[model samples]
Target: MGLPLLMLASGSAALAAPAAAANDETCRPTIESPWVRAAPPGAKSLAAYLVLRNGCGTAVEVVDVESLDFGTPMIHRTVEEGGVSRMRPAGKLVLAPGESLRFEPGGLHLMLMQPLRPLAEGDVARVRLVLADGRRLFAQFPVRRSAP
Candidate 1:
């Protein structure tokens, strides 16, 4: 009924040109196959997982993630300690050269809260990822009933 709480970060606004360029020596992040898992009816929380491919020789740290659909879109990791599983904020996520990080269930994922609306099958959401180097990568996530 109202505007979505999730919105993309503005980190890339200043570096749009360079970020769009391919294979830039400074910093570059290749995002591929991003999608949101299906949620049950009346579900208040959801997770978005994707693969971040680092092209630059140096490592890139994901400083923050912004989404207008959630009250707080943060980077969180599932920690299993003492045989107990809990979710905590991941201050920063790092990616090395040619490295691809997977954000999947039961692991690191984007903790989306207070969805603007229930995610239905075949729905697509736009998300923006901000890298520590001030690069913003835009991505669209398809809402799938299940993930392989």
Candidate 2:
């Protein structure tokens, strides 16, 4: 296979931390507990969950998400309205500085589509987290039957 084309945006690299630490230059974000659910064969897509935090100083905008194993990867969130629930595209979420956002079932998540191969337990999926500043962060999501 060839190298994947990076879909990066020149939106001023971490020019301003979106949610909390807009001015904190000392801010370094982190991704924790990243995991993807095990799917049956022939499954078209999968949902990955994790915790994103920007503790201390500064802010960052997660511009986009991409994966080599999947053709399409998008950040989305589950919303409840009028007693009904649905999934919608979460366009550039901003987390308050010193705050942590949880992406779990029935909440914010990464939708990985068009899997290159079926991922099962013990397998891992690697994804790129693009920040607004044109910087990129790599995350490895282990496949699991359920949240650990």
Candidate 3:
């Protein structure tokens, strides 16, 4: 009985190692030039853009995007079908090693909806990129009228 219990403990320890490694600094993705576009007064929705780069050796998925400043913030991609451009909510985003995904106007972007308050230029918005492995990367995006 003691031998079996010891083996079980050893197996459990091994299983916990990967969960600890999920938050490893080396595996964390990087974000560059994160900024939110200033919206007109009374506007219910706004757009934010950023560049997400994965420098890790393995692929990672950005499971969700969230913010406390807005009621709903989601990842969106602009698509063109039959020469008509439409914006749609982009599902989970997966980044391969050494890949940099851009969120820019007329392309992929973050849809900031239901602003809690009017955000003006020079203000900053706090957002988080939640990874599939339970790691949350927080970012502050400055509000601007144009691309930074």
Candidate 4:
């Protein structure tokens, strides 16, 4: 009887360990230091920057972006061609396990166009990041008067 009890306890412990690991993996990527550049009055669009950290063991892809304050929110990247800078669409951003991606000026960023209303310094905009795995994460980006 004593041996049977010990075996049962050890089996339960082994089962619980896997369950804890699964829980950790389920907690997808995290967004850090999110902010939006404040545009001048009557400007058609603005830029947003942030850092995405993947805490899970598998890779995750950001497929789409949505914002209530802007008509269209899309990922974009800045490229230099013969010293001329141009902006282009970034199809999808994939973050590997334990990796971090930065979206900053002169690099990858979010192009927020057609503001639903005028935005000013210190205002907050809510943006949703849709992952390819069907997980949606919401972030509040504060409007800054200047770039960092």
Candidate No. with top TM-score: 3
Q: Can you tell me which runs of candidate 2 are displaced by over 4 Å?
A: 1-27
Residue-wise lDDT of candidate 2 within 119-146, one digit each (tens)?
Answer: 9899999988788866676899999999
Using all chains and alpha carbons, the TM-scores for the candidates as numbered come to: 0.76, 0.78, 0.85, 0.81
In candidate 1, position 75 carries an lDDT of: 83
Q: Give the C-alpha lDDT of model 4.
A: 0.89
Error of 1 at 115 (Å): 0.8
Candidate 4 stretches greater than 4 Å from native: 1-25
- Candidates 1 and 4, the one with greater TM-score: 4
Error of 2 at 21 (Å): 14
Superposed by TM-score, candidate 1 places the C-alpha of residue 120 at a distance from the truth, in angstroms, of 0.6
lDDT per residue (tens digit) for residues 1-148 in model 3: 9999999999999999987676676668998999999988888988999999999988889878889899998988999999999998887799999999999999999999999988899999999988888788899999999998
Which stretches of model 3 miss by more than 4 angstroms? Answer: 1-19, 23-26
Q: What is the lDDT of residue 19 in candidate 2?
A: 37
Deviation from native of the Cα of residue 102 in model 1, angstroms? 0.9
lDDT of each: 0.78, 0.83, 0.91, 0.89
Superior candidate under TM-score, 2 versus 4: 4
lDDT of 1: 0.78
